[model samples]
Target: MRTPPTIPAHLPRLAARFDLSSEDLGNCAERCAARVQRLADLWSHAGTPPGQVMRTLRRTAKRHSVYMPQKDSAAECINRMSDPAWWRRALRKRFRAVELHAIQTGAVHRHASPYVSAKALRRHELNAARLAAQMDGLEAINQTTGEAVPMSDLIEASLANPANRRAALMARIKGIETSALAKSHVGLFLTITCPSRMHPRHSMSGAPNAAYDGTYPGRAHAYLSRVWSTATRRAAHLGLTAYGLRVVEPHHDACPHWHLLVFTPADQADAYADNLRAYALADSPNELGAQERRFTVKRIDPAKGSAVGYVAKYVSKSIDGEGVDFDSESDNDGRAAARRQIAWARTWGIRQFQFFGVPPITPTRELYRVSAAGLPGLALPELHQACKANDYAAWLATVEAHELRLGVDYAERESTRYRGETTKAISGLTVEGGDLTQPLSLVTRCDTWRIEPRAKGQAQAPSERAATGSDFSPWTRFNNSAPIDAKGLFPSDAPRAKTEKKGEEGETAVRGSVLHRAPLPGAGRGDWESARPAA
Candidate 1:
């Protein structure tokens, strides 16, 4: 026997907002069709494009034809109209408001007149249906579990905090000194890692092992630090005058892995790579006595989309009873004893455990069902209101109103048996940072840094020696043609500032008559006019 589908809990609110009965919905469809036909007739009489007029007429006819019968008939009666045309038409009328709004607001293409483009209608309908299905699936899950799960909960659980991610990325950029490195068209980063193994008994009994005494991390942190410092001192020897480095410990497989971000000239990259490898291999493990250690080095380019999210995932204790147990053995006697020990351990109850990185907080199906149950036959306005109120329950109500207003005939029947298409249209945009799942439009701007090999034909200037404080002035060059302020301040919009220029005798002397600003501003300073000028 088949069970009847229950109306969602938000149905009452949806019913109140919209006249969504089967008969009234049918009337609305008829009215929309009549209006479309009228527009088409008027366009034809006024010498509108034949293609545009015909397209509108055909779309209106199709939408009305499918929806009229669906609203008037029972679920079984509408179930019979399960053809592609019926499904498409029903969807078009369902999202008619969205298409109309898109055209009116000029957000979509200018040619996308609701009366002239069936394509626009088709797009809105398809998007709405897909969005509805996703919400429905979430709702079904929630209902099964008899709980309420909000969309915010899902976002918070699956994604990292945006602020933290942004701050870390900005800090990395600041260390790279982007302005200086931009001229060379290269970015460099230093990477470091340490791997160690722990004995089961040593960790369990709190005893120190010879190889890893829970001290010194079993790897050579001190050695790497010394080597890095020395390398920085000799940076100019390797054609690397400007650089930046960051040391981070990533969580992976219940262990820590050292990660470094280094920047250097593209030409000197190979030298830096070679030196780091040699240093790592030559160093001895701290706790492994005389055993030599080795490390891996990989060069990454941000322009080529090589950088991935640096979230740490360590193999720590599981929130649930799922993880490696060092005491378990494969031998028959050992396995039997291990099983017995596990049983005893389970009886003693498990302790509260937390992982080092972000934890999983995805909502269950039951919560969505509870949320969806409250909403039925909601219209677009009601949906907008619900979103404004931050009420998921009201949002579901709006969805239900739309479904009912559009008529449940074709959608209900097709939804029961439909499988989604496998093909997808390609999006022409390319994103440089963040995970693929992140929305591309949400990205405001990309901070670009480059690393390219110095061209072979480009000769180094005779005067172009290693960088010195005198070679690069503290103040940037500024144009003096613009008007100065009352306090002798340069225009705030000046391109550059004047500074002490290096003379042949290595003596610092003012080279230009342009004015400059002090690093800090004085009191009562409002604009360039009120600010003090540099000496």
Candidate 2:
């Protein structure tokens, strides 16, 4: 039995108007009640109408009751919305002091906050709920064939396997090295950074930066994105074509910077660098070290290392830290650093790596699902031969040729096609631009799955399997099984039931039978051979 929490004396009328009572407050917890009281006081102090404040509280209560219909959940919802202290504790696992401070102070309300916004966290929580449902042995039943797979298993397979992701990135890099781009173009390793004001802390000392402008990591990321867009737009106006990988990484202060491994015509590399620098310093141009640190371009020398080698560490560090030894930003080992980077990216919904001036990865993945032979009649038919051959380099060439023939901006076309889809999963590709009308769609994912709890006896616990010594060799679906087709060789030694008339005799007889039937070591042609019947 739980005790009812005591509501503040001043809030009695407000609580009464909302039809809430002390018994109902019991579910809210003392801490939650206090936070709600605090928010109510804040509302009153702001000169809000008494009726409006009551209505607002009731609305928050009702909105939250949809998911949690408990008596006290409404009060808890109010606490979640207004309490800065609660937000700090809730986000402590993923973000620290400076970041949390920014989140609490910058937002006008909890609904539209920055740096891991309420919406993003709610989305993550929903995903976590789905994952939890899967972990609870829920199976995704395919409606078509009536086949079912563990949702957890599907999730694991769909997630980017670190090793495979790194391998694919390296393969793409190698493809670029051997292509025409490598012949007439120079590889430039460019670094674009946010202004000093955006970073909250110093990189070397881990202390707050004196020039910090109190910008959240998410906002700073957006600023960097805008700057890059401006620079790229300028480059486009100059007719300077560049293509390659872009890696976004966080500074020690949680501000973002970009590392681009770009291949551009040798003659235009300097011009591209100049434009990037100009835009990078467009804001706060007079800040200390702005000129030197904002944008940097390094020309890759083939004699030193391949362009892939130059960006491999960045790719590895961002993904799984396969070949990375240390991370200077976090002062941690490769794997630990990678974990932090991934956390930062997920929290802020930032894309860590992107391939520019190439066919979008989403479309390529969709293309792989469809029959290559059938692609000749589909949109972007130039990619059909490349898909048939499974050659990435050839695909790159064909996409470029196709773009030239279409006379449409490839990036814009792909971007437009990808919009208006649900964020849950990529259903398929929508072909836009070129001769394609309005948006010709392809239905690649036709399977519909519904998650349901595992039926009794459908799955076995590991402990149960271990105790039984069960080996579903060449037949049953145990995860671990023997290679040979041997079955029933190791019979169970479960005790036999006792007879009512001769319990002791029955037990003795059963024991004797079990021992007689049990296979013994070296019983074939060794000492036990004398016990065997005549051949």
Model 1 CA deviation exceeding 4 Å by range: 1-165, 171-181, 187-190, 195-210, 217-223, 236-239, 250-257, 285-293, 306-535
Task: Give the TM-score comparing model 2 with the true structure, all chains together.
Answer: 0.58
Q: List per-prediction Cα lDDT, in the order shown.
A: 0.30, 0.53
Error of 1 at 390 (Å): 31
Writing each residue's lDDT as its tens digit, candidate 2 over 327-423 gives 7766667876676566567766689988888656556544443433333234366564454343566667766644522211111112111222111
What global local distance difference test value does model 2 have?
0.53
